[model samples]
Target: MPKPAPGLPTREQILDFIATSSTPAGKREIAKAFGLTAQQKIILKAMLKDMADEGLIDSAPGRAFHKMGGVPKVTVLRIVDADDGGNVWAVPENWHAETPAPRLRVRERKRGALGVGDRILARTEEAGNGWIAHPMKALARGEELILGVLRQEGSKLWLQGVEKKERREFQVSDAGEGKPGDLVLAEKAGRPPRITARVTEVLGDPFAPRSFSLIAIHKLGIPTVFSPETIEGAEKIAKTPLGEGFGENGREDLRHVPIVAIDPADARDHDDAVWATSDDDPKNDGGWKAIVAIADVSFYVRPGSDLDREARRRGNSVYFPDRVVPMLPEILSADVCSLKQGADRAALVCHMQIGKSGELKSWRFTRAVVRIAANIAYEDAQAAIDGQIDHPLTDTALKPLWACWRALYKAREKRSPLDLDLPERRVVLDEKGRIMSVAPRERLDAHKLIEDYMIAANVAAAKALEAKKAPVMYRVHEEPSREKLVALKDYLKTFGVEFALGQVVRPATFNHILDKVGEVDFRQQVMEQVLRTQTQAYYAPANHGHFGLALGSYAHFTSPIRRYADLIVHRALVSAYKLGPGGLTEGEAAGMERIGEGISALERRAMEAERDTIDRYVAAFLAERVGQVVETRITGVTNFGFFATVEGIGGDGLMPVRDIGGEYFRFDEAARKLVGEHSGTEYASGQRLPLRLAEANPVSGALRFEMVDGKGAAPERDVKPARVIKRRGRPANIRHQGRKR
Candidate 1:
């Protein structure tokens, strides 16, 4: 057919031409291709000028043109990995790693002071083969990198810092490319004034198999693989037994005592052992003598040594479902320092006397040489105690140990600590390192026995040091703040339970609430709330008395092979008691404050890593079963959505308000619920509901759920609607509408 009337091209048509063109097309080329007349060409020129002004197209001198708005004016980026010629590459702050992020060539001057884990906001522009960026603001600059997921909201990107205690999200540069669910390594550029980040590298998707542990390990900057020097030092220490040079001298020989080690079945390190017997003294009638000997790690890993430094840096061993990242190398943690059965090992022993009432009468600390009479798991020990299983040492050793545990438990009961019986979920992995199942780890009497003994031993160590005026790092759990107590009282009022809030609330105060909740339907929910209100336990140079344990003074003095704090306590005991050569040095004593803070940070880091790994594995396990209806109890309710833990699997998922029917909901913080506007339906914490798994994104470690039961509000007389009145016309749950903005 003949050509129709020549007319000016629409914006869409012009854009399509430019996009489909083999190369960046100019005005003359566009006019000729579209068969525009001379008058139409004039109009086309004006349109091209307008498009250029609108950032729709880039017009260069001499008619060169290209697509515009490809590069952001400002974005956050990090120099992830160093390339050849000292050049480094960067990804966008909100990268999901769905694909490769845009490569950036930062100027040499801009790259100065920038290192891995350093985050920076920069101005970016397209250069010859890649984008060039000038870092305008340095957000955070540190040696440690943060591993987290990148999330995009409109044109802005945020890093959901996976650090356990960090609740605030940090802004990231948008220049580099990342999806919502990508695991990324980020860095802080300068300092506190600028709180932003740049994605240095994308680790992987959070939901991928085995990726969960990796993300946690990387995010927390946990040293999974030991350094060559640490490994070599550990290997050297392992080759020479501690008894050869470091043992026997000034050491009490406790090998004659029938001290047996109790631990988990899978535990490789036997750090502490217990021995108990009736005191035959008529003056001390109805009394028992108990001895707790912990592995002497300081005997091998001395001060300022490679192993010691690494252990100090790690703070404590991180236990993951797939594997363990030991504070010390395997040679020390699993062999030399491990108190194995019938093997002579050096130890820090506490000889304690307990009267008939389980009250500690007297205690003293000393260095010792001991041989573990037996090594038993918690399950086997419990079985023997229950008369279901028989062991060679059942009558002679196990029975006395059980009796000692019973007496100590009586003391524990008398103390009336905040006994919130929250069962911790344990992830069981198969041979291939995939999650087989998730279940609550049974808390047996044997477990409690070990715990009680450890507590007693720790207390003795603190007492010994305090008596000597030695500098000690106390495991302090401060009392709940006034604000937290007020919130707790308000929450308890919703359940028709009232707490006397004015007086000094002690662990005993929480125990009353916990005991009252045991028979309630929402026991777990109430326990969780109580736990949330309690302060986190951490090491401090000054004693602040542990509130949760109801202890006037406490310090971690068990499992020196796993915990650096315990190692320090061992050194302090040696120093205070003048036991031997491996004692706390003056330099270490002076720097105890810094060390305490550092180890406390590491402990929080490990907790975050462990929790994140579990979340990832749970997400992976449920990925294949999308759309299956599952039962869950709402654990948390916000304005946007409610979070629930899946009943059997124990995986937490978000049920967005938008998916909870058409009713607009309002968040009632006091009630911990979302109240529907028109429908009057409420989704509150502790409410059991059926949900269908709509999506499981392993990369993001996020699960989305849809409401299965279309149940409305509770019965009229039975329920008390929150005071928040619903409004008409607009939606009430606007905050929960969408995160992408």
Candidate 2:
């Protein structure tokens, strides 16, 4: 064999040097460290290239070298999983190795617990067998990837956002295999002034049926596919015997109680059943006894298990117009855990005693075996009560439920919860996923009856946990902040409505303000303002009164099949009552705060995804009606434009100031209006107007409108250049400010 070059390092030596380097080691650094001669340097470069080809070392930015299977000493990582012992695991942020990315145990240092999808900057070291990462700092979360259609504008490709409020078109840098008008998922490649994106996946046609929900599923990072382990766990748990000993083993038998579930007509799963009857005790005349049985999801999804982890990661089931992204596998969420009629199901039942005045006198929790007598749709239940349909279970089950709900309604009236009668739009889709129609869902008394019972049961669970001094995840909705209240007051003054800021605020206060508005349009406008004034409700370990429900304590204990918060509550109840196994564990109890925060964030994400999908669906439904005049109500106003929603169908469309025609409009911030200088015409929220739909983009869920009578013409006189305005505080164009009258 020929003699080796004097400074050439062996393969093992090169790998060790790259792995242990304090700083990024490129070819020059490696050559310097080995003291290579000038001629040896050329040989070293060839050796490094051969090593890279052999998959021994990889090159990063700045031509830095790293061990192919190892992470850089200092690098960015994305958290992927958490173990049973509460340890988090992460992988390289930009992994491109042929092998699966190595999981590195993250050792947090005086920082909050990290969750899946969180990004961090870490310093890594090779431990005895595995890699360990010490987090240097947490990175701001990257924006979710965009799911949109690729469009070609004069040979320049642009990616259109699939959200109603996303107005900017991202410049496409690399289109990959995506063609113009194809649905594609793209990631941000460059930052602003000239924002750009690179298409990652070409998802066929953008106008295909069912594409609307797919856009949301990918854009929001919602998990639609379950892991194999979780599915196997669910299947195994689903086969567990529910009636071996006939409720003799740590379970009460309530199969003969004639419980009934009332839900929507197209409900996919029934998670709650209600049973009520008159209180037979003479001392509690006119009172009622009730049981609210919720699906025993905690029993099937135990802590530290695969099912539990996946459920926690989902936070809650996301319901779209066409389908549902369930938190649990179908075996559990749809079949085993659902309260199906005539099938014996294990449940966590809440037994409550009510007084004549509908006050909850006493409550207890127990594990039980239940058999739902019927699963009736809300419309059918209301119909039976009105004598429109003759049903066998109605007189026996539905009547008693209504009787019980009447008493609860009395209590609800006294508490006077915030009753904003906002109409929720429902998107009905055909089997092919094409839009059939969009309309406001009917509000019925039967719906209110079921809601009240659930609320009562949720309150009982919270108070029961408090009595046992156990952990509780309260559904907290705090009073509005002073800033929001002040804004609401300023807006209300525009309507000549007096709102006293000094008075202590309650749900009833808003309800009273809404009651005084006789006009429906004005009432809706005020309702919107009231909603903007309220704080978002969320789950927390600490107690904060539920302002919307007018309850001193509240917790979700129903629908465990859909919501993780309710599952946690179920575990708490089981541990508090000593009902059986599947109780809250010590580790879970200790991390309640972190769990609350993570799930709350997931809930917000789900809401946004659902809303975006609905907007897309609405836009698609109205695409055929372009150039037609429609009745609209102004919903919001800004300096640049005013937003309005269709009268019968709800889809927001913007009327830009430039399209309003022949005038320069001044934005009135406090009053939330726009006044045209030349025409002396005024536009404000709650004003009914006729607008011609000019353009509708289904890919972006955006709609553009113009005044039905006004021509699209420039203002008669030249005016000062327009500038961006902040959403808060006083308006820059207020009278007598920087103006000559």
Candidate 3:
């Protein structure tokens, strides 16, 4: 509640009123606006006077005591209406704390705020006195705080404390005597500038804050972020192919594999396609067979051409909250080489065999021009498999494909393969790129068919490298790091499930754990956490074999369209076995190795940039659902808040530490939790709990979650458990957030 027309109301009430206002208003205006009366006015004036003493606010030039225009928006939102009415008006992210913590917080708006070149952290306060703030830590000792001060007001400085307050007359920090109003520059002095000051250096009024964030990102040179120049250069190199004249040099032809690609309904670039079935081919005893055809990107993207030069520079495509900074331009990623429906395109095909007993019978790799019979969405093909979607592809030719998918699933189960599949959440957007809704993306049987075949092809690549003794960069997924495993074991122990943390944890152990806990209510959360413990598998010359797929050897081979490594690997295989680039010069191999490393580094950065973009979209999606409570599973625990996997959405967000008001919580780094020092209030990782959706900022991609008792609430149950969704390059699609909330 806003202090009623301020008849000298309490500081608490005044603060609350300030927090609630969405727009800046005069003190008297606020009083009149909110209906503050007689004594309340007196009390409010005194409170504002005290805050003025603290340099938190300054009265407007030539303005009377009751008039407004002094409050620093940042501090106003800090303590005002922070409780009770909910911190609605925010600075664009969770919390207004001034700590060095990585979380975004509210900083102050300057004189020329909202103008070009004038950077200010935005803060919002509704008329109800609710406020939310995000802080910016840009000022440092000796650094310049450049700002164009717009207005000058008759404001006096007073020093104030809880019991007593006094006025103070001081000289202006700016060179000239601080006049009624003057834009001035404030350099950080002996120590870092105070976090509370709104105006640092007043540059001038006519300036802009437009695209300030992008500028900062570029200036800071954060390794993960990329510039437009970097993106532009890489795109050009992707257009020209390297080894062009060698197409007819004796590579095996599998142009008639009847291959099809099944990706998310929203996927644009198709990289890998599969045609799988029972092949009684006389190569060995009759067995199930797979022909995994990948878009032959290297065939067109040369090593040092303009296209290759840009590709080399970008390393890979970068994704941001609302957009994609593609490594290759749309000309390549989605067109020319895109394996779209009914397109006869060139590819590097991996022919593989799986025995009846769920074993890799045999495999072969070849490069050729292949035709895609169809391009189907994962769900559509899954519908075809489940008999829910009776489409032409299923009736005309996919029935046998369905059989192959079933066989692959069986092979996966019998092999005790590591099921690293996690739910995927898609953030749907409207025309202007605003997130309209968040929905879960399913992984159907048809998805498994493609996944299994890709795995086979990957293994084939790894095997070929091993056979020729080539120092190729393999996509090695080593065992979970010991530290991660220990933390995981501790987390599970809190749940009373003693996982065997012996000398080693094999893939089968995870599979076993999944089987044992699959029927439990909180199993979804547990499974994803277990999945998270596994380090992100990466490419290296040293083969650490992927544990998740239960494969002896593996490398990404079927997505050259989106991944540079796939292109390199495709070139290596073709040269080694087909076109004869057999032996590398010492210098050549070293150069390729160096190139691999560069590409790997860029790949990581691009992935981060992509995640950053997705995060922003998801944040926007969640912000629209304030006050909605959903059953959720705690996927991670942090000091700030616990992150949850909501039921239907494949996304994650934080349940902020401050919003969880019931008890003072501490995160147990060993086990990942926030527990009350007293009252035994505990929020454990992987615990299914009810989270009241509080705030989500799309711009910063931050989520604020609140935890409440979920005792009687039904545990979040998944309709179809977590599964990995592949989109043929960059980072894999990670869906989450449907843990019921």
lDDT of residue 705 for candidate 2: 87
Name the candidate that leads on TM-score.
2
| TM-score (C-alpha, index-matched) for candidate 3 | 0.62
lDDT per residue (tens digit) for residues 73-137 in model 3: 44322111121222222222222222221212233344212211222333433233332344343
Better-scoring candidate (lDDT), 2 or 3? 2
lDDT of 1 by residue, 157-186 (tens): 888865434657878864255678787887
In order, the Cα lDDT scores of the candidates are: 0.77, 0.85, 0.56
Alpha-carbon deviation at 426 in model 1, angstroms: 1.0
Which tens-of-lDDT digit does each residue in 254-320 have in candidate 2? 9989999999999999999999999989876669999999998888888999999999999999999
Candidate 1 displacement at residue 336 in angstroms: 0.7
* lDDT rank order: 2, 1, 3
Task: Per model, state how many residue pairs clash.
Answer: 21, 0, 97
Candidate 1's C-alpha runs over 4 A off are: 1-209, 239-249, 709-741
Work out candidate 2's RMSD over C-alphas.
16.5
RMSD of every prediction: 20.5, 16.5, 22.3
